[model samples]
Target: MKTLQASRAPRLFPLRLSFRFPLAALAVMGVLFFSPAHAERLKELASIQGVRDNPLIGYGLMVGLDGTGDQTMQTPFTTQSLNNMLQQLGITIPQGVNMQLKNVAAVMVTATLPSFARPGQNIDVTVSSMGNAKSLRGGTLLMTPLKGIDGATYAVAQGNMVVGGAGASANGSKVQVNQLSSGRIPAGALVERTVEAAVGAEGTFAIELNRSDFGTTQRAVDAINRQFGAGTAEAIDARAIRVRAPEPQQRVGFLARLEDLEVTPTQASARVVVNARTGSVVMNQAVRVKDCAIAHGSLSVVINTEPVVSQPGAFSGGSTVAAQTSQISVNQGGGAIQMVRGGASLSDVVKGLNALGANPQDLVSILQAMKTAGALSAELEII
Candidate 1:
């Protein structure tokens, strides 16, 4: 009919290009076989020893402070915490009446509590400036208490600080920005006390681990005995692990389903860190090395002084003098040897230390001369 429908539209365009090349190779083999890896959960890698965070502290008293407070006669503990809060409020003063408080200051506060935190819940304190105050901005904080580290008194704080920074000086030039002697109060304390925590009482629980490996604590005790079964968890060493739980009324739904399972941890060792004041370097994917050959070059000296004002010709009696001159210069550079090869990972030792083009402080002296010639295999640290 129209040349047989143009030969059946080129045979249905090769059967829709053979079903779009096997659905684009099954979407690239489902992204190279399901791609996952970085897993997590086990309650964000462990920590159940009575779930933590107590800290607390206290001391308080920050008052108004428009005059940048704290000079209460060279901070004699801000006039002895304002004569012990006016003798615990009975206010009897009148003795050596030397209270020249330009607006008070003496702070400290702090906070934390967290883990199950009950009593009245609030927590957020901070405060700071314990003496030379100079700037607690528009203060307030009075109530105080907070304690903990065994000194008892769980929380109390007080509020109104929030000083995110600001300063001024006048005749001596000054212009501050963020952190006018520390602040922050929001939800200023409260939690009165409750740190008991017997976790799962006698059904056994443990976990711990926030880093101590033994192959990530035996792969989190075989992913918690393969989701609770074979002897239901164990390990107890390279940072705890124990387990067995499930009775204190099913231990909070068995630790909320064993801290959402997931597992996969185990893979840290190789190290490399090196931040000696920001030349950074990091390395980790089990950092590897071995077959090396780097050569990187640099040298560079430079000097240049110059300062010659010696005019005496016009006067003849020689009177104007001042002379100094230096030049020096070295440079060096051009070395290039680079070979690298052996590197079982950490991106082949960062592509063989970026093929020796050095830089990060000359790749921290070529990875401390490839870890003093043993051809680096990891653990260098430096911090």
Candidate 2:
């Protein structure tokens, strides 16, 4: 397979939480700012066509599972596989000998042979037990051929599993963290074949932008045409741009130069994404708010229990019974609605939200209401 070779991009730290004291946390809770230039770049949003790695997967067997393998009676494949393996090793078992296995497990192995991977090059592979095996913590993968979608074998994986987790039990109960039934074997797979990639064979080539945006696509085309000529680059669609390569003789050299030319893409569309489960609110830099009024207050509904005992008429073999009664009350706390005007900056919006001092989950519902009222200038997407 093709082993893609490219310089690693610089690490980007997401603007999440910053260490601060309690008071400072409240002070900066709603204030937002974007002083960093090119927080996200156009190149980051795009990708080159035919420059992606392929996913190759195959089924294999794991041996030596410390008696934690699947029950042979249920997973018959384990017994059949073991018998076949033994026969291949010149150890034929009697036809009447019913075999039960406790150390063999069927597993699936997966690996990604990066573009331009050469023959005999080792790559890491993930071996995941697929049978009812309790754990693949200490097992060995047999020679398994990883194949591409075209059904062509590209790599061979075989190695002792390197499970980075451990678990033990005294009784029948089990407790595991992370994963013990799946392990990774670093550099355990050897590339047996290479995928042919023609970056610039005859001459012409194409660049595929990861995101489909007409404005971004047009800008990319313009950038390339400026470097070459008007007819050199053309936008095929919102995602793909075709560029006529240099003469066939200078194809490779031409591509090498083109990749380094930087072009700034258009600004992304305004959008806001909301996570329903976590109550997380994420908004793009372009997101804004219109004039609106908001008043958010917590409504606490509490139920308290008071246990009481009831006694039957004394004597006559009567027993006393205990019962619990619950008392409920609702506390609604709200104030006059605050008027928020349009063209309000993100910082202003943050200030208004922080004033409410609502919990994270409550803040989500408030934002949803604001979005539905057309006061939120960006698209609201809840996930």
Candidate 3:
């Protein structure tokens, strides 16, 4: 079965704006772009259409390492695996045999199952050591079959691994650049089985948006209907659209025609995304702000430390004793409260924050508080 028919791939939200430090580009009224696109329900930029790829993963091993493989003694799995290989090669070690190999490591195999991947097609794979392998440099991945959750093997992988960086250690010191425990095997896997195709069927086909938005879905349906004639398409929800197509025999041709049609979809909802850990803020063009004033000030905190000495009491046969003590001090920072003017555009908001000279991380909090106060007109999401 073609994955294109029975889709196992899941969708994800497309894009988001940041609240911490959103790029400020003023969208003036009636600007050709800001204006309702001329091709209202039929334009490329306004529509979301594409066949997406899916993810597939498997666990396997990497061999031929340069003495950097997993310490087999510590990882019994590695030792056991080595024995199995020896036996496979027609070599037999006595019972309770032990091996000290330096070129093997148990690794996890991962690959992306392309949309509609066919059997015998080549796909790239990544090999990552699961055990405490010092490095995966100069290694080769053995034959590993990648399978789906259904335990059906879909691909067979094997190739030389390419580690992006190098590292070295000597005299209890080490230096490295980039990671070495993981490596990439270019076009390492051969598709053994294809995921069934499930999309294009009889006269009608269903299109699911990456994100569920009533406006976008309706626009998509309208655009499709306009191209093929009225009633050709219908919106089932903010996420799915059902379009009438040719009979079973013509489904493929119908899809080809459908993909090329342009649709000026309705604008996505206004939303701001904030990544607190990275101090990143993004805001979509659709976002706006309510008229409001902001007063931001920094409270300072200071600390001081000092050392002290103490003398011991006199005693008949005792030498003088000495002790040490420490002192600490604190101070709070102060700054003049600055007033931020009411803002209607992204530029205004950025200008206000720049005036505060607030760092990215701190700005994240400020934007969240603004949203909470109903001063910002957009959904705020933190990730």
Candidate 4:
């Protein structure tokens, strides 16, 4: 009996050891198969070519204001529009009788009709005064037919205006905040028509990237093909990729899964943007700098003028005259040459620029000079 027990214990130990080895190998493989930290979903990097929003605009009238409407005398179009609306309502105004309206203003209503919108969906609208009106506050937009670029009515807008501005005036003094001529109405328009969106009509569709890059386009195509199957996607150019889609009945579901797949995009190119008017400088993370030297200084010129009087000497019948004397001075500040070390990373570049102790305005000039001398690897753009 003792020998049988010993033989069974030895067999159990080998079995346990075999199980442990397989488990440890699985954990290591799982870590290596995971996606990278910078991977992003395909939806954020690209969109379907034919799916987009359409802009709709219409001319409308806003009423119910507190003496802040357009003056009919200056804006004759306002009076004409009012008269036309009145005629449509079966109300007749006497000829040669001018209507002095103070509670109505002419406005332009605008809204965006999103893709896949039905006939009854609601959208926000913006009303802007087209005349010289004091404000559009406390006013309500009338029924306006919003039209698309093709001259077709797509939606109807009518709602109370919500102006996020205020102003008061008394004794010829006034103060105001924000804008008073434009206001927004939340969900003020109802879609009356639909814009046809033809996607995958030919058994295929296209993906358009927000920014053009050959490397990103190729990677995206590869990832899509790997997920679906070989020959599923093909690169058309740096900005577009064509993919074979399933039948119409299964197209939506297939796109839903396709957009969720993750892929790593190529790194952005190095670039720098400078605002010339505001003296603002912005640099991206990919920007790098080569070894260079910079010297910055300022030059100023000042002028002074004084009035001089000359009197007749000992009443010699000479008239007194007034003259002017002017003085000018030029000043040049001392500028010392500074050394900048070559940088491979964004942090190193920033530290080297900061070491010069120059203001943003001066830094703009220095960067321009560096670009000209071939010391800056990034493109310099002034806005």
Candidate 5:
């Protein structure tokens, strides 16, 4: 009986061990597989320094309006521009002949000439009324030369305006939706020139970070060097990284691969942004707060007025007197002091603030006070 009991005890021990091993293995695997993901591609963090869009602007006239165009008398420039355009078209208006046109509005045409844009490529343009035009709906923009800051024509814009608003006015009352003075023309400008992007000249180029950070720059350099080889990339500063490229023909493929490499950026600084006009409060994950006491309350004033009339007796030969009686009252709400525990994380900080039972507008003031008192461990920015 002793031998049988010992053998049965060993069997029971093995069964219990086997059952617990699988659960322990599963817990380790779950941790490895379900950890928080934080890796982001290089392209999201930086951009090629020289590759950017250029702004182009032009002045032109919009015709075919439904009597909502600029008043020529009020905007003399509109009349002068019309005369010059007519003269160029060989339709000479007699001198001193005032032409009252109600369908022409002067406008400013604007567009962005993208990088690597070649000749004959179309781009969208925005047309804005520069005069007292009631609406720019249903107007045709004339051929206008869009020029860059260098005073060189880069594109020509001409198309029908597509206004997204509707407005009607009658009997001195006006009802409008959205905007009437500005409209967009889809694919209205033809690119006549190309802006050269000097990237990777002399077998090297620069990657500029959107925000300047030394840790992020060092991490990017290290990631690039590890992927390509030692001494392949180096940090110029906190915001720029210089990288060596392969041959000119292979540069594009190399850059495509480089942009895909994943990098984990350093944790950002704690910051709290408050929009005073909108009563908005936003904070980053790194925000924290020290143990503090806060007391918040609201004060309101009420004014009530009533008209009182005093009439003399009938046939007393006295005029009635009119008077106003006003009663003003002030009320202050109770605010109990609350003790807030020190917060080590963003969630804890939020909980501590929520305990004060303050609205967003009130929170703005509270955050400002906490920052002044050195209780809030974050940069407070009011916009």
Candidate 6:
């Protein structure tokens, strides 16, 4: 019995050792399968060529303001536009009439004509005051013709301006919120003409990536081919792809299915965008860093001025005079040099920066210096 028990124990030990190898292999496979990068839909990553929006602009006038309109004396264009409009309505004012208009404001109307928009389709419009108007609140925009870059009128805009802000002034002291000079009107312009598109016109449609990347373009092509058939899609360049599609009538359904196909996008280039005015810092996942050191400090200067009155004694002949006294002081913050190890990932880079106890503005300065020193292996953009 003892011999059999010893033999069974030895066999069980080997079985346990055999299981470890498979468990280790699974752990490694799990790590590879759960990578941080995720698959993205083609529609979100690219746009179909010839499918875009057109910009429309026009000059217009706003009326019925509660004494917050443009000053006609300063803005001659406003008075001219009003006069021209009145004349068109068969009401001509005499020459040198010296009309003092207070409720009229000159404005520029703008809108975006979406792709495939048909005539009579209502689109939103934006009205911006072109003159020195205090506010556009409680004002109605006149009928204005909106023209595209081709110099053809495409739509007409007319509606009441919806101001986003309000203000009050008394004795030259005023308070305001948001913006009061510009406003938007929903469904304000009726499309007068259509901007033709040639989507899949010649049995081929082009796709343009939002960002140019050869690997991503190839992946997109591969995805389309897998869903449709081999040789159905071809990569034109890093930014565009050409695909053989169905006829114009069936093109919409084909594109609908193709856009839903998911493909793993290529890794993004390492980059850091900095907003100088807002002190904002944004970095993508691919950002990396080499070993570096940073030291930051701040210096403050203060100056104070006080008026001192010099008085003479009761019987003295000296005159009293006022003298100015000034005091100046400077304070320098303590600085420490910190060692930062090389970072292979974005999180590591963030941790390294956090270890230096630097604020956003300081981080911007440090990043710029690091980039100059070649420690940062990423593009830095400031806007």
Please write out the lDDT profile of model 4 over residues 148-243, one tens digit for every residue.
999999999999989999999999999999999999999999999999899999888999999899999999999999999999999999999999
In candidate 3, stretches whose alpha carbon ends up further than 4 angstroms from where it belongs are 1-54, 88-90, 247-249, 309-337
Ten-residue region with minimum lDDT total, candidate 1: 9-18
TM-score of each: 0.44, 0.84, 0.80, 0.85, 0.88, 0.86
Off by over 4 Å in 5: 1-37
- Pitting candidate 5 against candidate 6, the one with the higher TM-score is 5
Query: Using TM-score as the measure, what is the rank order of every candidate, best first?
Result: 5, 6, 4, 2, 3, 1
Tell me the spans in candidate 1 whose CA falls farther than 4 Å from its real position. 1-45, 61-70, 73-84, 87-89, 92-129, 133-144, 147-192, 196-218, 221-244, 249-265, 269-271, 276-285, 290-295, 304-324, 341-360, 364-383
lDDT per residue for candidate 2 within 1-383, as digits (tens), equals 99999997534322223232132243233336643234234346566566779999998889887999878888888788888888989999998887788888999999999987999899999998878998897888999999999999999999999887888887787767778889999999999999878875656678888778887788777777887789888988888888887777777666666776676666677787767887666665566778677776778899999999988996768899999999999999864465555544555555555555566677677778988898887887878
* Candidate 3 structure quality by residue, lDDT tens digits, 1-383: 65556756433222122334333422122321233434432323333234556667887778888888888778998777767777988988899767787888999898998877898899999888889999999888888889887888889999898999899999999999999999898999999888765664454567776667787777777777777899988888878787775777776676767767665566767777888777677766566766544444566554554455455566755565555555544544434444555555655555555565566677777788888888778898888
lDDT of 1 by residue, 180-290 (tens): 998788898888888878886877868898888788788878877877788988887998988877767678887888889887876667767677776766665666788
Better of 2 and 6 by lDDT: 6
The alpha-carbon deviation from the true structure for residue 114 of candidate 1, after best TM-score superposition, in angstroms, is 10
lDDT of each: 0.76, 0.76, 0.71, 0.85, 0.85, 0.85
**lDDT for 79 (candidate 5):** 95
Error of 2 at 231 (Å): 2.5
Top TM-score prediction, candidate number: 5
Model 1: which residue pairs collide?
Answer: none
Measured by C-alpha RMSD in angstroms, how accurate is candidate 4? Answer: 19.3
**In terms of TM-score, which candidate is stronger, 2 or 3?**
2
